[model samples]
Each structure stands twice: as C-alpha cells, then as structure tokens.
Target chain A: MSEADPVLLNPEVARPYLDRGGDLPALPLGPEGLDRHTRRDLLKEEMAIAKEFHGGAMWPYAVAAFSCFAVWLAFFPLAIMGELNLTVGFVLSCIFATGGYVTSHEAMHSNIGRPGEKNRWLNEAVGAVSTIPIVFPFSMARMMHLEHHYHCNDPVKDPDYTDEAPNALWAWYKTWYNRQPGVDGSIHHYKRILAGMGTPEAARALKETMLLQLVFMAVLFTMAWSGYAIEAGLLWWLPRHIGLSYIRFYLSWAPHHPREGKTGRYEQANIFKSRLGHVLSMGMETHMIHHLYPGIPNHRTRKAYLALKPVLQQRGVDCSAL
Target chain B: MQAAVRGLFSWMPLLFGIGFIAPLIAQIMQRLDIPAPAGISPILFGLLIGAPWGLLTVVRGRWL
Candidate 1:
C-alpha cells in the first residue's frame, strides 16, 4: 500500500473537487504511475532479496529451548544443595527462562522448522513444550499472536494496544491492573475468530491445554508444601515471573511505544537502533520493516529492513523507528 | 454455546481478581487488622484491591 501523499499547499495548485465549495482535492490515481505488472515484479524482487537471510532452521530454536531448560532446571538442585546462593541462582534462571521464551515466540510463528507441510505441527509441538514452564499454551498463544498481526496498533481491536493515551509508567501499570476488570476480553473473541477461519482443531487443542495452568499451579504448591518454598519460589515462580514481565515490558511495551508522537499506521511501530536492544529483544527492535512483510521470519528482520531501506526512504515511509 | 463461554471468560478476570485479593484482605484483617490508610479514598482502595487481581489475571498473557 502507498503512503498518503502530502496535500497541495495552494488551492490554485490543486485539482478542484467538482462538488467542493472550496476544498482542495486529495491525491488522484493516474496513468503516470507504476503499472500492476511492474509493482508485482518489484515486490517479487525485494522478497527474493529478503529470502537470503530468512531462516528455516530448527536447530537454533532447539538449542535455545534446551539451554533454558538445562540452566533453569540445574539451578534448582544446586541451590537446594547449598552449592550456589539461592538469590543468585534465581536471578540467573530468570534470565535463561526469558531466552527460552524467545524460542517459544519463534515457534509460535512457525519459524522454528523447515518451511514444509510436515514441519508445521512439529514447530507447534516444540513451542508447546517449551512454553509449559512459563504457563503458556502454544495453540492459545498462536491464536492471539495472529490477531496481534492481523490488527496491529488498533486500540479497540488489538489486544496488545491497551493504553490509547500517553501516561507515565506507574500510571499505565495502575490503569492496567487496578482499574480494569475482565481484561484481555479480546482473547476469547479472537479464539472464535481463529476457529471460524477453518482452524477449529487448533482452537480445540487450545481448550485442552487450559488444564496445564492448573498443573503448573499444582506443581508449585507441591514444591512449596514439601518445605522447599525458597527453591520453588526461585526455580519455578521467579523465572516465570521474570518471563512474564519481560514479555510485557520488553517485547510488548518497548517495541510499540516511544512513537515520537507519530501514530500513523505505518509510523507507529518501534525499532531498536541500539545493538543491545536488538540482541535483548531477539531482533524485534527493527520492527516496522518486519510488520511491512510479516512473512520475513524474526531472525532476518534486521537484514530485510536494511535491504529495503532505500525503497522505504524513497516511498516517504517513516523508518525513524529504526 | 460460544456466547456463553465468552460471557463466562469475560467475568473471569473479575472473579480471579476477587479470588486473589479476598484472601489477602482476610489475612490482613486477621493478622494485622490493617485499616484503609489515612487520606486514602474508598475509590483508590477499591482500585488498589482490583489492580493486583487484574494484574494476576493477565500476567499469564498468551500474547504481549
């Protein structure tokens, strides 16, 4: 889609609206524009360039998931046996758990597997297992994520865009938590939307996984009741707490906020210009370009954005987010 | 059936909010007998109680 053209500076310099009493006409479509054939050809050319860094590898996601699992699980026993400080162990485990969630996010997008029919389910399954420790249901998460993409930046329609007005951090927190009842009502509706799209089986799969939250609760209680409250708190609860906050604050707030007052549909997306922000956010920092072409997997979004930088600039699309 | 499920879920955050806070309120009343802080409005107290419940309901967010 084309960016909105600037309005004419002088009424005499504008094409007059036939019915207008005194209004200047909007940008008109014309014969002098790029033809349909050329548009398609150019898009195909850019996508081909994007494909070079677009990954279809499962090993990296697997390695990230396994790293989280091993490091987080190992922290428990070592802390219990007094080999490592409980607080330190807990802090370190939370960091690794956040890494695991990055894998889960990739998995949700079906980017953790080879681009093939058979590997789709494999990706979802790996995501499900990887997210269990964080109390996330993969199928459910997939549904919501698709909605986020489908309705990005829509205040009413998108679940992620809660605060429509600007406010301080504490004010937003208080508004989100203390004020709202029945929050995330968008999720139940989005589930129906997904099911209606011929993925009823995926919806049913999500329903079945709701019990896992209870199972997670039971696991925590069992650990706490067995006189390992500190261990349970650190290894289980703390890391997941970190995971939850990291997802909300880092992945959610940081990537979308700081709009520099430009809330136009294409301009509102946030990008990380800093290397640390890019690394920490799993490459979601260069987000506006990714949103332009959602099919370009996360690992390669930065590369794809850079590849199309000239085009974005020439089109007058804002890349200041980057 | 879909509407009914949706209605039920729409109430869940409110229910979970009360569930999470009612016990905490009870514990405070039993142990410390804490009163509403001086100069705190009833509306503010209500919000404080509701916020954690809301926070807990959503912190297990599926997306974002």
Candidate 2:
C-alpha cells in the first residue's frame, strides 16, 4: 500500500469512535476480508475494536495522578530542610518529571475533557499544571502538539521533526541540541511558529511561555540566593533537562524515526519495542494508537494496541519492530 | 518583551552557573574540605569553574 496523505484527524470524528464499545462479533475479521478493505477501512475497524477501552471522565485520573507532580515539587523543600536526601530526591524527581508529559499529553488531546464538555476546564487545568516539573507551558505544548498531529511528518511544518536523526545516539544528542539557546528547534522553533500564526490563541501561548520562563528562572535564582542552590539543581533544573531528553527520545524521536519523506497517517508513527518497556517508556511504545485514536487514554493504549494489531498489520503499518 | 527575553537569555546561562551551580559546588567543596587554589574563596573557585563551563555550553551547546 502507498503512503496515505497526511491529513488532519478530526477529534469530532474521533469522538464517536472513542465512545464505549459495542459487542464484538464472535470471530475477528478474517484475513481475506481484511485484505479486501483499504487502509481507511482498517483504521475505522481498528478504532471500533479499541473503542471499548476508552471513555468516561478522565479528570479523576488526571487529578489523582497530579500527586506525582506534587510529590516531585515537595522534594525541593524536603531536601532543603534535610528531611530528604538530595541523591534520592534527584532520582525520584527524574522519574516523576519523565512521567509528567503523558498526563499533559492526554489533556492536549482533550481525553480528560472534550471541548465544550463541562469538565473541559479540568482538562486545561491538568494540562497546564502537570508539566511544571519540566518547565513546559501547556498552552505552547497544546498548540504545537496539535500542529504535529495535523502535519505529522511534514519536515517543514512538524514541530517535532527536529527530533529526527539517522541513528539512536544522534537522536539522543539531537534532543539536547534542539534545546540549545541558538537552535531553531524545541521552544525556539515554537516561538517562531507562534509569532507567524498571529492568532489570539498563539499570542496567548507566547505570553504564557514567557511568563513561565520568567517564573522558572526567578525560582532558581531565589533558591540559589537563599542557599538552596543545591536543592534547586537536584530537585528541578537537572531533573527537567533529564526529563526533556528522555521524553524527546521516546515520545518524539523513536516513534517517528526516518521521518524524512513519510507523511501518511499510518506512516508517520510506528510501533517499536522499548527496552524500557511500555510503562517505563511512558506508554509511547504504542504511540501509533495515540496518533490514530487520540481519545484513548495513555494507560489503556497497550491493551488497545494489542487488540488493534491485526488491523494495523492489514493497513501495511510496520509492526515488525514490536 | 522580545528585548527582555533576549536580554534575559543573553546572560541566563552564565548567571545560572554563577547564581545556582557555583553555590552548590562551593557548598560541596566546603563539605569535602577541598582547598581552593591560591586560597581563593570556595564560591569564587566554584564561579571560576562553573561560569566558563556554562559559557562554553551556551556557545557550543554541550557541557563537555
């Protein structure tokens, strides 16, 4: 099958497909019948099969999960008071910060609360607050993430395309390189895109980003000046850098490697086995399911992906890596 | 705001090293009782090392 054109996945369409599932037929679709269907048909069938796994107000999970960030934040004061060891704090902070993106990712897709839904505020709140550990503003992340979805692997338009590299080691290095001050990747690239958009939403995101950066620096400076510099570095700054690298590697680079020419819905993201496993990789091993049915929550993607693997194979997606 | 951002970033790396990292290094050196060269203050010694490293990282985009 040829690579499908890169087209926007409509959450409105994704919504119906995300509803609670109906009973599956006693037998799965046969190989002969699947072969007769096009990729789009298989995509719909896959969505139908996985629909059972996702729905309901995810705000509770979002709220409960926020304690992870709370705990990470608390490590700062705890370390300062000598109640917690800096080495232990640093390690836990890294894990919490690494996991922060997935919670915010759900909110980016409105899985926690769909637009116009009553709990939508909670979605935005979760999205906004969850990534403080990594110093990423939700407004910027949401806008750029939506763009990545619409553009997928379009080298020019995809904000995440910078994470692409020829090999694993370079991919890891690109994550750090992209964050360098002079680089036109990462937040700097997002700034350029926002400036070009000139929309109210874009302007607001830019404003929020600037404000967040200021706050981050202010806190670091304050902590340092107050003799808590070690606490600041161990609890927040170093952990953030580590988290960004890990998140960029697994969530951005790994799923979409060799991103040069591929732009299809099925071609943009692939399934891969992570040495860190599904949970440690932050549910990104099955990221193809996320690109297809974004409404599926992170915790459920593994099961959903397994159930949908047959259809994904039928659609000519490369499942060999998994 | 653009100017402010630019201005802030111009010295951000260096200032971060001086204000945050240097103090940490100084504290560590003091705890370990590592003598600063020429009897320079521990904080000064930390700044001497951390500031240049930060400057290089900002310019070269890597700590090493």
Candidate 3:
C-alpha cells in the first residue's frame, strides 16, 4: 500500500481502540432477542457451554483497577498544566475512563474477581476508583445496577426507567444509577444487605463517607476558585460528562435505541454484526447473552454468544442484518 | 478529502497534547519555580509547537 492509501476502519484494528481494555461493551442479543420458550431451550441446550465461560480472575482485575488510576493520574497533571486541549485531551481521558468503567461493570458482577465480599471489597474499590473521572459514587451505582438487572426495563420499578423510554436515543439517554435523584445516595440498599451491623457503626461509616466527600469537593472547588477554570473544565467536568456519554452511547443508545419496547428474548436490545458495532461496544454487542447469562463475564460474552448462536438461530432468533 | 477528515479526527489527541497541553505545562513549570533556561511566554511557544505537531500527527496516524 502507498503512503496515501486509505486505511479501512476494519475490525481487528478499530475494535481494540474502541473497546479500550480487553472488555467489550455488551451488545444486546436483539430486543427480546430470544423468546422465553427459545430462551428456555437455549438454557437447556447451551447453558453448559455458557457456564464454562463463567467464573473470574485476579490479575485482570488488578490491570483494570490500576489502569483506571493510571489514566486519571496521567490526564490530571497534563490537564492541570494545560498540556491537553480541552476537546481532544478530554476525549482521550474519557475513552480511558470509560474503559475503566466498563471493566468496573464486571467488577460489580465480581466477574473479574471474587464475589460476595470474598471479592466485594476489591470489586467496590475498583468501581470507586474508576468513577473518579466521572464523579459517580461506586457503591451507589453498584446497588442501582443490581436493581437494573433485576427489573431490566420494568417501568416504575427499575429506578433507571420510571417513564416510558423516549422515542429517541432511548437507551443511551436512560439516567445513570447515582446520577438520578430520590434514591439512596449512600448505597443504603447494599448496606441493608450487610446483616447484623449495629446502628452506631452504620452512623459512623456514613459520617466518614460524607466527610471524605466534603473534603474532596472543597479541594476541587478551591482550585477552580483560583482561576483553574479552563483546567477544571478540561480535566474534571468535561471528562466526566464525556466518559458517561461515551458509555451511554455504546451501551444504551446504540443497542437499545434500535429495538425499544420489545418483550422477552426480544427486549429492546440487538446484536450488531458490523465490526464497528463490536468495536464501539466491545463484547456488549452480544448483550442478550449477558442479560440472559449475567454470570458470563465481559471477555466470555462473545465466546458464549458464538457457542449458542447456532442453537439460537435454529429457534428463529434474529441473527440477520450483519 | 474523506480520508483527511477521518485522519484529523483520529489524530486530535496527539494534536491537542502538543499545542494545548505542552504550553500549559510550560506555564505550570514556570509557576513552580522551575528553570526555563530563559524567559518566555511558554504558553505561546507551546501553542506554536503543538498546533503543527497535532496536525502532522493526525495526518500520520490516519494515513501512514
């Protein structure tokens, strides 16, 4: 190829960049992509294979945990020094930050590590660290996500979708967990699950969390108060919005928008056959697999999808439009 | 023309890092009492260097 030859935005090259770390964003299986009958059949037939893709690892969790810190660490000072342009540099930070969040989603599921406090602390820690760029509280997001999975799109129940999904970029526009109002801002749901905890201890922990938050905010506002307006815009506020938008774009808007209001195995999610789809969302392009088999981790969603695809298609699942 | 646009988008990170990031960093260094080896509006110098670097990197990343 000549120097000026056009470069195709092919899968192998583009997918990695879009996927950030190895975790692919989950693509919906196809809104209600699988009928309940078919879903049951799939479970009976392919659940074993999907199960093989389950379980978690440690080293990958460390990479994802530390990488999130590394990205913010690098982006902040550069942003502080004005070494980064607001548009491009902030976007870069968003990309890395989104990667951290994506992996952190798995951490929420304990897919990248142990679950149920065997790995709960690690999971929550990674999630908390990852959200720094976005300024969301990790514990709150985790509890909300657990509900999101339980209700999926149950109107008035799944805190995420109280109203009808707008006839628009519906999925992408759904409110984030902690970003919304009128819920447990301090992760009371999970705390409730933590049994036998006395009131005084709970009060103490809550007091500390609030204090830490107050101090953190005081420092940021102090800096911004002192004419780091552009710096704050570039590093903090801008990247937080960008990172959240990026995730919603790939995870919510792209997959859910196409097929909202569909029911069972046919819910408002779909699989994208295009490399760009896979590239943009990672394995999330196979979202149905994750929804149906939440136990399957990020790296394994695709593998399970490929494994069950034949069975799914045989039962009239929509695998068309690639 | 299309290639150029895509190239430009792909290369923004590099471009901004040089033009915007570099200059601000210089100013920050000066604020921290670091030696500049001379006097200057490091921000302006940074912009001058970064803009060209950003543009060229965009081209290289996209095409080559």
Candidate 4:
C-alpha cells in the first residue's frame, strides 16, 4: 500500500488530533485503488463472545456487591467503639466500595442478568445500597456512557471527554488553588463534585449521595449522638466522597487522550486499547470495541481488546500508557 | 502564604492524632481479642460496610 492513499488519512482519523489543541498535519492516504479490509468484520466474532460473557457475569457481580455491603455494615459499629482504627476501616471499606461499584457497573451494562426489568431493578437496588441512588439509573448511565464510547476523542461530544473551554479553565483554577495551598488540587476538584453544585449530572449524583448521607447521619446521630456524628463525619462521609471523586476523575481521563498526533474516534479507540487497556477495565479498556459494539459486556471486553490489538497497530494506531 | 502555612501547621495535629490514635486503638482491640462490633440491623450493617467499602474499593482499583 502506497502512502498517498486518502483513505489512510481519513477525516475520522485526523479530526480528533486537531481537537487536542495541536496543529493539523497532512496525512497521506495509503495506496490508491487498494481494497480496504472489512474493519468491523475483524471484531465481529470477538464482539459476539464479549456480549455472551457480560450476560453471564452480571449476576455474580451483583451478588459480590451485596455480600460486601453486608460485611461493611457488620463491621461498622467498631468505628464507634474505637475498636477499629480509621485506616483499617478505611481500607476495608474501600474494598467493599469497589465491589459495589463493579457490580453497579455491570448492572448498568445489564451484564448481571437479562437486559430487562429484572436487571433494572437489581441495578437500582444495588445502586441504592452502594449510595448511588436509583435516581441516576443504569439506563441513563448506559446512554451517556454509550455516547462517550461513540465520540471517545471528540472533545465536544463525549460527555466524559471534557476539554471544553470552561471545564478546562475550572480544571486549571482547581490546580492552581491546590498548588497554592499545598493541598492536592485533585482533592479540591473532588470536593466540588461532592458538593453537587456543578453540572447537571453531578447534581443528580450529589442528590443521591446526600440522601444517603442524611440517612447515615440520622443513624450516627442516634447512636451515642456525639460519637456517631464524629465517626460518621470523619471516617464515613469524607472518605467515601473523596474516594468516589478520585476514581471518577481517573477513569474519565484514562481512555481518551491524544497519541501520535491523532485524537479522533479511531485514535481514542487506539488509546483505549493501548494505554488504558487491561483485563480489569472489564470491557472498558477495549474502548474501541465498546464504541463499535455497546451491547458487549465488560467481562468479555478483554478478549475483544486483545483480538484487535495487532490489527489496530498495523493501521498506524498507537496506544501509549498514560 | 500565611494562611497556607497556618493551615498546614494546624493539620499537623490532626494528622498526628489520627495516625497515632487509630493504630493504638487497633492494637488495643487486638490485644483484648475484641471483634469489631456489627451494626444493629442487617440493612444498617450493609450500609456501614457496603457504603465505605464500595467507595474505597473503587478508588483503590482505579487509582492504585
């Protein structure tokens, strides 16, 4: 294939690079009149398997989340008794939180059971227990997340890919604020989200969190009043918000950064497959695959991701670690 | 700058207090062979354990 073919430097490949605040380079499309291979076909088989795997794994993920929740509550009063220290409680709590989040994520994708009412109820119930209310339903997240996959590198369209001017400015302001005070700027960013005074999505999430917090406060307030309040405020509330905000920020950015001067859908896929690609991404890492096939479950994503790695690389797509 | 410095200074006590007190308490509990207390209700137990654990796990899994 000669380097002069226009297809090689198609608009889809070039547009994202330009959006990442870079100069546009002249891309040479490979050899004229060359037959393009069926790109989607390459992933067809893997995509099918990915869907199947996600379907089966969703229930197990839900059960795991519920179990973690049970364990967390059983051990929580120890905080009041001063039997369990903050760090240990914090660490153990984090483990349970992760399990819950993973279960919710699977439910969001309908990976826990059949994609119907049963799955929705399970997702919402699990979500409520995890402190993410059913108000921000899995259906809503799935829809937005699908958009994120569809326009992975498009700075304007992908809700998750926020390179918008105002957002960027806020991010910059946040960094400066943290640096000036020797506090991690990221923490400030997180606190802002926890406040639930930002975007609509944030507001919705915050509402759910606040409701849960209120219930938590009531319980703590009733239990030896002062002791419960102190433990709940110091250990439970602050840490949960901080931890949730931190993870959200990292996951939001990991999959769609610019690489090798490309920043469009294809390059985003490349990044998703390369830098952020991992077994744990649970199908999230195979961002390109997810974009192309949203119905595929997270559990099956690892296989699809690996299957397309070599082919994507050959097409001049570079996936680099962040 | 002064505010930053003061804030930093103030946090010293909080840091030391939490760091010292937490582990010390855990050690005492260990020595006494006391098991951590469970929540009063099943749902409460789930909330206490699930809520914090869920947040921590998600953060650790993603960041670490």
Candidate 5:
C-alpha cells in the first residue's frame, strides 16, 4: 500500500473497534514463550515499523516558531495600548507557549536534525528560545518519560497519572471538592495535576522549571534595562506563558480522561478516539496505538494504530472514542 | 443536562478570574456541601472567568 493511503493514514476509518465497543480479549503474553532469537526478530520488526514515522523536516519547526511570533506581535498592541486584556493576552500567551513547546518537543526527539553535539546545541537553543530550558536535558526527561510510556496509567509510577489516592484524606478532599455530577471528569483530574505539582515530585519539576525562569528573568531584566523590557515581555514572556499553558492543557489530559469504564490507574485504556481528538492533539489522539507501541513517532501512529486496533480489541483493550 | 449547564455557567466565571480560583471554588463548594464537578482545573477555571472580563474590556473600548 502507498504510504499516504487514506485508510492507512487515518485512524478513524481504520479502527472501528474503538467505536463499536464490547469487552476486549486478553493480549497474548508471548505465546508459549518463544525462543530468544525469534523474539528478537519480532522486536526488530516492531522497531522498524515504529521508525517508519521517525523525524519530520526541520522547516515545520521554523514555520511554527515564526507564525507564533507574528501572532504575538499582532497581540502586542492589545497588551500595551489597552487595559491588560487578560483573556486575549492569556489566550495569545498560550499560543506562544505552544509554539515554544512544540519546538522544544521536536528538539527533545532530535527531530530538528541529526543526533550528536550539533543536534544537542541546536536543541538547547530551541529550548532556550521556548523559555523552558531545564526540560531540554532530554536524558533526564526521556528517562522519566520512557518510564511513563512503559507503565502508562500506573498511578504509582506514571508521571502523567493524577488519579486520587484511595485512602488519603487529600483524595477525599478532591472527590468532594472537584468531582462534579455530569460533566467529563477532566477538570477534576486536571486540578489534581495542578495540586499534585505542589507535591515533592512536582517540586522537583518546579526546580527545573525555575532554572528556565531564571534565564527568562535575566533576559527580561536585560531588555528592561535597555529600555525595551515592556516590549520584550509583550513579545516574549507573556506570550510564552499563554502558549505553554494552552498547549500543556491541550496536549496532556485530553488523550487520557473522559473515557468510559476507566476507573483506577492501570486500567490500560486508550482515550483518544474522535476526529476532534486527533485534530486538536495534532494526531496524538490515537492514544491506544501510542501505548501499545511507544516507539512509534507521532506522524505514522494513526495508520499503525488502526492496523493493530482490531487485534488490540480482541485482546480486551479499550480503544479510544474516535 | 440543565444541571450540567448551570454548573458550567456558575463555575466558568469563578475559574476565569484567577489561576487559583478553581481550586478555591472547589474547596468552597466542598465545604458548602455542594457537589463539585470533575475534569476542571484551577488554570482552566481561571481562563473561563477571565474570558468574559476580556470581552468586557474589549466592549468598553478599554482594549486597543
């Protein structure tokens, strides 16, 4: 099949099992325990498939960054001439943040260029421009993130999992204070992330966050002393927060929560099921496919995900909505 | 659905005012014996409350 076949490329049309739901069958745990060589070959095949979607041309990163900067410039007048249009400013900031974030994201995966010293410097530069520097040390984030991929939804281990603790008083408070009757539980769950970030692990994350903040502050101060601080903050600082917050919110939670029959952590659910999910998340919405094959790059995931959905469903896994 | 809409309308304003507003509202709602809904965060709550204020600023010609 051609690489760009609609059926192959689109998860929505290819994976019907997510929408047509019933109980899934159990996944095979290496039938009869194959020999080492056979298993190695299978793994190699999987890795090859995963690598097929690896790396996009670097131009998208430049394009995204420039577009984001233009948008921020357009909004600069609103922040300067008007009375702190918090909403528009905030929304605009979010856009900036997302741009910064996406660039940083590409850098993390070394998608901007070849791997090594050159790539490292470029990645760090991109990350610095994004205003979230500490996350640039991909070795650290990759270590944590890889663990997250391996044990997604494992409450105790997954950095992304923010479900309530069963026995904790804090958990009780969360349920009482946040759990609304009818709306999707995303807001409550997201609150848990915000609150949880205050915890020890989050404190660690914050330390890393602060390092970047310090660098950002220095830049701001330099601009201010140069008599261009207000312009700099408008052009850079303010918009960065807006974009980052929106992108973080948009990217982080939507793929996981609001699914049916999902309960405690370790439920092994794929929550991105709709066309909206795919579009809004920039194709990250084929979540079940992601969990099944974490090595698959973002671009090629939809097709691979769809190809495996039927098998995954037969194994009793809950595919996402779309 | 009506209850959902009512809850959203009520909460949206609170959420938008400040980043911490949602958590504060969630805290208060818990204390008042009111049912708090799920899936909302303090940040988003702040955005919700902030949106209208922004619109008002625009409407009043305060935003240039």
Candidate 6:
C-alpha cells in the first residue's frame, strides 16, 4: 500500500495523524481481507468453543459487584461520622474505586444485558451505579467507550487516545495531566468528541457529565464545610484520582500503546503481562480478546482467549504473551 | 448556558483545592506538630503556598 492509500481511513486505522507527531508504522490493518486457511469443519470447531463463553450469566455478577461498590461508597460518610476508621476506609475505598470501572465496562459492552435481552434494564442499572466512585456517568462512559472501539487508536476520534504515551511513567502522568483544568483530556476531551458527533446519545452524555460533575463538587464542598475535608479527600477525591490513573494505565494505554497507525482490529490491542496480575490489573492481559468479541464477559475472557488462541494466531494476531 | 457551566466546572478544582483543601491540610499538619515557616498562621501559609500553585494549574493546566 502506498502512503496515500485510502485504506488508512478505514475507521479501524488511526489515520490523519491529527497532530500526534511521529511516524506511524505502515503495516496492513487488522484481519480484514485475509482468508483463514482453516478447513470449514475446523473453523466451525474453533468458533463453537468460543461461542460457549458468550452468554447472559454475567448479569448476577455485575449486579452483585455494583451493590458492593455502592455500599462501599456509602460507608464513606460513616468514616466522616467517626463511626469508621478513616485510614481503613480510605484503603478500602481505593480498592473499590479502582475495581468499579471493570464492572461498568462490562455493562458498557452490554455483556450484562445485551440488546433485546430480557434483563437489559439490569445492565443499564449496573452501568449507572458502578462508576459513582470515579464520578463518571454511565451515559458518557458508554458513548465514549463505543467510540473508542470504533476508532481505537484514532488520535482525533478516540477519547482514550490521550492516554497514549511513550512509557509506563508517562502513561501514568497523562491520566492526571489529561484532567487538569483547560487540558482537553479525560472528560474534557470526551466532551469535545461528543460535541462533534451531534447525536442524541452524545447530547445525553454531555448533560449527564455536567450533572455528575456538579454533584461530585457539591459533595466535596459539603464535606469540606462540615469539617470533614480530610475524610472527603481520602475517601473520594484522592481515590478517584488514583483509580482514574490506574484504570487509564491498564485498561487504555497498556492494551493499546504505541497507538500510531494501529487502526486495524487485531493490531489495535495486545496481550501483555501485567505487573499487577490479571485481577489486580483489571483483566487487561486478555483485553485484545474483548476487543475482538465484546460479548464475552470479563471473567470469561481468559478462558475464551485460550480457547480461541489458535484461530487468532492463524489470523496473524500476536498472542505470544499469553 | 452549558458553556458557562463548563467554564465554572473547569475553574472549580483550583478554587476548591486552594481555598478548602490546602488550608485544611495546613491545619492537619499543625495538629501533627509541624510548624509553618516564618511563624506564619497555618491558614496564611496554606494560602501563600496554594494560591500560586492553584493559579499556575488553572493557567497552564498542570501543577508540575
């Protein structure tokens, strides 16, 4: 393919550069147009095993996890009331806040309640409540997340492209840098993308984002005024910052690092060893599988990735990490 | 109206961080027996330090 090939705009390819300076590798994007050499029977065998992992059993776990996080967030006030130890509360809040995104993420992909399924309300409910710690609204998260999927490494279109950095330390710095006032990163960046889209979902997301931010600020101000500023800082504000940084590092940057020119589906995400391990790292080691088959629930991704590994390798995916 | 709201939201962190969190932190440090430099009052010390840092973040969009 020449430098001017139109395939660069395939929505899956990160194209137009959008001022993210540096040379993008000119590899052919993703698995599109590639023929799998597997016999029909063998291909069917691979798909059948993979399909077994995609289903609705994820709802119960999603609901239970959402309840735990909500209850945990509720306990923050008890610490302010002097009924709980602030140190203990802060530690637990950090754990819950960091873990909250994966559950909401599962709901974002509709793994909890797929469209037309009987339990779709439960999915939306989980998504709505799960991110209370991080203060990101479900509507905004869903809209932005879906767009990231559609344009994974797109610097201009991908809300998460801001997380892209040269190394782990820079990636960590970006999570905070993106949210600083006047920086078009994090929610601010998403607001720009949503404004450009001009869809009902985008509008709703923007509205929800505003309301959530107001509520978050009101709560912090209330706590500070009530002589519980320390409690508020440890319980919510600090935890949210730490959790956002961790979530962005593992969930966005690590999975899709060196994002330039990587617009293809298979090329978009990678399997890599996480220093924090699978559960601690938010199950991002198997993130590429989730990108390929979002319907597979988070808990089942490792198993499904193993089952589908041969087929992925056959299709030119880099699966050596697992 | 939305733009106005967004502008307010953008200014909030700096305002809250400097005005509330910084002074409160000063009080906590004092309680832990840490003395402010130049014999300054804890709240004044907090304001002295936080005001410039917060203004910088608001202007440059980063603290560091």
After superposition on all CA atoms, what RMSD does each candidate show versus the true structure?
A: 8.3, 8.6, 18.1, 12.4, 15.6, 7.2
lDDT of 3 by residue, B1-64 (tens): 5356434435544645553445555556555767454465655555565566656655553211
Candidate 3 per-residue lDDT, tens place, A219-319, comes to 45454435454565566655666677666556655555443345455454566663465646666678778877777877777778888788767656676
Native-referenced DockQ of model 3: 0.02
Task: Kindly report which residue stretches of model 5 are placed more than 4 angstroms away from their true locations once superposed.
Answer: A1-48, A66-90, A131-147, A163-208, A214-250, A258-271, A291-295, A310-316, B1-64
Off by over 4 Å in 3: A1-41, A56-58, A77-89, A116-120, A162-217, A258-268, A273-275, B1-64
Candidate 2 ranges with C-alpha deviation above 4 Å: A1-43, A56-60, B54-64
The complex in candidate 1 yields a DockQ of 0.08
**Angstrom error at residue B8, model 1:** 12
Error of 6 at A48 (Å): 2.8
Ranking by DockQ: 2, 6, 1, 4, 5, 3
Candidate 5 docking class = incorrect
Off by over 4 Å in 1: A1-45, A56-58, A77-84, A114-122, A163-182, A185-199, A202-209, A258-268, A272-276, B1-64
DockQ of all predictions against the true structure, Cα-based: 0.08, 0.51, 0.02, 0.04, 0.03, 0.44
Interface RMSD of 2: 2.1
Q: Scored by Cα lDDT, where does model 6 land?
A: 0.80
Best by DockQ: 2
Clashing residue pairs, backbone N/CA/C < 3 A, model 1: A177-B51, A178-B51, A272-A285
Per residue, candidate 1 scores C-alpha lDDT tens digits across A1-322 of 3423333433444445434666543353222233345445556776677667666556777777776677667776786676878777777777766666677777777776645767776676668767766676777776677667777776654655653335447424623342233343323444445565576666664564546654655565455434455566677766776666566555656667653444554465665564467878667677776666666667778878888776555445556756
Worst 10 residues of 4 chain A by lDDT: A29-38
TM-score of chain B of each: 0.41, 0.80, 0.48, 0.43, 0.34, 0.74
Interface RMSD of each: 8.2, 2.1, 14.6, 11.7, 16.9, 2.1
Off-target runs (Cα >4 Å) in candidate 6 are A1-46, B37-40
Residue-wise C-alpha lDDT for candidate 6, range A165-198, written one tens digit per residue: 9999999988989987778898888888888889
**Residue A183 error for model 4, in Å?**
16
* Candidate 3's TM-score: 0.59
DockQ of 5: 0.03
| 2 versus 4: better DockQ goes to | 2
